[model samples]
Target: MGVLSGVKIIEMVGLGPGPFCGMLLADLGADVIAVERPAADAGNPRPWELCSRGKRSMVLDVKKPGAVETFLELIDGADALIEGMRPGVMERLGLGPEVCLARRPSLVYGRMTGWGQYGPLSQVAGHDANYVAVSGALWLATQSGQQPDAPPGLLGDVAGGALYLAIGLLAGILRARQDGQGQVVDAAMVDGSAHLLNFAISFLPDHYGGSFEKARPAALGMHWDRPYLCADGEWIVIQAVEPKFYAELIRRLGLDQDERFVNEQRNPAAWATLGDELSVLFKTKSRAEWTRLLEGTDTCFAPVLAPEEAAAHPHNIARDIYKTIDGVLQTAPAPRFSVTPSAELVSVPPRGAHTKDVLAELQINSKRTGDRGQATAVGSPG
Candidate 1:
């Protein structure tokens, strides 16, 4: 049992953010029914594709006659509906917000997209990198003279798209429960990515002591705010931005007595020189040696561990941050609750694995139905 134990969500299975949003809701104990397309190939499904955990899968071909009616019947009893199609795709399929909300007035309709439903580029095809590039987040991630290297799908797709859609759906569900009315949550990746960059955009102008032209370098490329290489070719990140932390870092490196560094700690013109000097010094020790010296100190230091290393780290092990399911290692459900904890992981379902079971549960008899002779239930229950 979880906090959202009784909540029901109908998920229109698509790619990327939509599935992720459904995964999050299912993780929190929502009874999510994923409506997968009939005859669509999913290739070889992997257990480590942890997004599909804790959900039931059903096959429904919306293009088939009466299939939309069957889908709408599921929507009629749902608290929310999640979809990630292009602007008018759902409308064309007869499962748009207007149709679903008319059937179930309190349904939280969540629409996830790169450019939203009504933007100038709403129907344009794009992925995570394109969305982040347009959002100015990718630009902000670049160093002084380096090309902007946005992370692969984490920033824009998962963070901006899936997380924001989940939040919007939750908020809409709350509002609907109170007012008996629901509205569409148009979660645009471009909009959410821009929103995520708010802190950096607001912080740079007023707080950074350098020209706007050199802002990226001054802020991120500073000696005390970046990663350095170790003798073993591993990396460690140091972010001693505050005076006390910086002083501690200098002391640990035995550079506190250097007159040039002591005098130029606050000077923007000296950052590159200081960074070069620090780089040379950092390369003298292996990552483990530095970790032994400064891992738990206030120098604001952390080793840049790879994914495998992170899973085995002591802190992660203590917190149980990762779980191995069926020999597949993956992260645990996050933001735990004290009262109603998230349910344990279940096996990811094969396509249409629960079709007969779900239809039976929904009380729709497929024996005497429409064109395809499959289950079809139309309209809201009286």
Candidate 2:
């Protein structure tokens, strides 16, 4: 059993972050039940959609007369509920936090959105790029004068939104277990993305003596810290921040005799020129040759491998960072525990695959609750 083996979560299935949060919980051993739309396209959730793994799926069309009540019944026994919708969408569906919390006093309600529930942009539509743009995260990704470019949707959706919502849900669950009072966790991509930028924001002023407006290209933009193309058109990145490591890197590259690199660590003006020189020098060797020379050294170097290439790398293979499940490649569950490591991932369920079993379990639970005079109403099939 995993650490969270007994925790139960009800996920109101939506796109992007909502499913991702459920996936995280499920991976950690929460019994996460995903309530998918009954009429959702069957061709959509392919096996490669890793977010749907380790979840029990059941279709419930809330627009049906009795479906809302059925959903609430599921909420009544759950420790937490995750929903990703606009500000008032849940309220319209009669499954809002207020109603769910009233029915289950200890329920941890996790709300995920691009802009929070009450912000000026709360009801406005947006995706990962737009949310990161508003949070000032997208701006930090650019060079001194280059246009900003985000790494697809990974930063804002998975890192900022889903991870924060999962953390908030877990924290709220702990508090509710102690005090028997539930609360809503408002997880907004805009807020979480801004929180993620705290490191860089503080580092700019405190460490670099620079502000965002007068942002000078620092370590991230410098030559030794970034990726350089190799002879075979592959790339490798090196970060030798400390003096010793930088000196070791220069020695390894036979650049100690170059006067242009001497004392260049202390000279910001020489960074660009040294970077260009290093760029030219790196292209003389293949990425594999550089990896052989620098990978295990204190110079802090790594080849820039693509997704498929990353899975095959010796280090990643040894660590089992990636697993192939039913012909689908996916990352393994992370932040492992010594006492109760997570189990191998189960197959993604088909929509409504567990409907009969879940409903039977709910019926048994309701009957037991009725014996104790605390029964909740369960809806009939629509």
Query: When superposed on Cα atoms, how far off is each prediction in RMSD?
Result: 4.1, 5.1
Most accurate candidate by lDDT: 1
Clash pairs detected, candidate 2: none
Tell me the lDDT of model 2 at 284. Answer: 95
> What are the runs in model 2 whose C-alpha is more than 4 Å off?
39-48, 213-221, 364-382
Residue 148's lDDT within candidate 2 is: 73
**Model 2, C-alpha of 299: deviation from truth (Å):** 0.6
TM-score of 2: 0.91
Please estimate how well model 1 matches the true structure, expressed as its whole-model Cα lDDT: 0.80
Which lDDT values do the candidates have, in the order given?
Answer: 0.80, 0.80
lDDT of 1 by residue, 1-382 (tens): 7889999999877777888889988889899998765442443553225677888877766655667777888887899998888888888778888898899999999998988888688878889999999998777767767877877988888999999999999999999999999999999999999998777766766666434445564354578888999999999999888889999989998989997677677777888899999999989999999999999999999999987899998999998888888887877787799999998876777656788887777677754234332322121100
